[model samples]
Target: MVTTTGVLFIVAAVVLFFFWIYGIVSFYFDLRYRFLPAVREHLRDDEQQARPDPEEYL
Candidate 1:
């Protein structure tokens, strides 16, 4: 009842679906580990700005 092309297409689709799922999982982890820390650091404003020496301008 099944054709060779149909089986091949089903296998290809399943492999592609798994790859898509893996990509989504990896992207989620990347944001959780790397992006969140960067966002927190950017939000914190406790550091003082550096003042240039007046003699340098003269």
Candidate 2:
């Protein structure tokens, strides 16, 4: 027979597991949709700016 404390512990474990899954999914989507694009754009812009003037470097 399950006691009240056991039931509470099981419930808390289930709740925390659900929250952990939720956080992982949220972070995955956020990084895929928003953060990566912004970073790629910044890197592309920096690469363009870093090219030396043809007259100065050649």
Lowest lDDT block of 10, candidate 1: 44-53
Q: List the residue pairs that clash in candidate 2.
A: none
Q: Best-fitting candidate, measured by lDDT?
A: 2
For residues 1-58, write the lDDT of model 1, one tens digit per residue.
Answer: 9999999999999999999999999999999999988887766633322555678899
Task: Point out the worst 10-residue segment of candidate 2 by lDDT.
Answer: 49-58
Superposing all C-alpha atoms, what RMSD in Å does each candidate have to the true structure? 6.1, 3.0
* Residue 30, model 1, lDDT: 93
Per-residue error (Å), model 2, residue 40: 0.4
Candidate 1's TM-score reads: 0.72
Model 2 lDDT per residue over 1-58, tens place: 9999999999999999999999999999999999999999999999999998799877
Cα TM-score per model: 0.72, 0.76
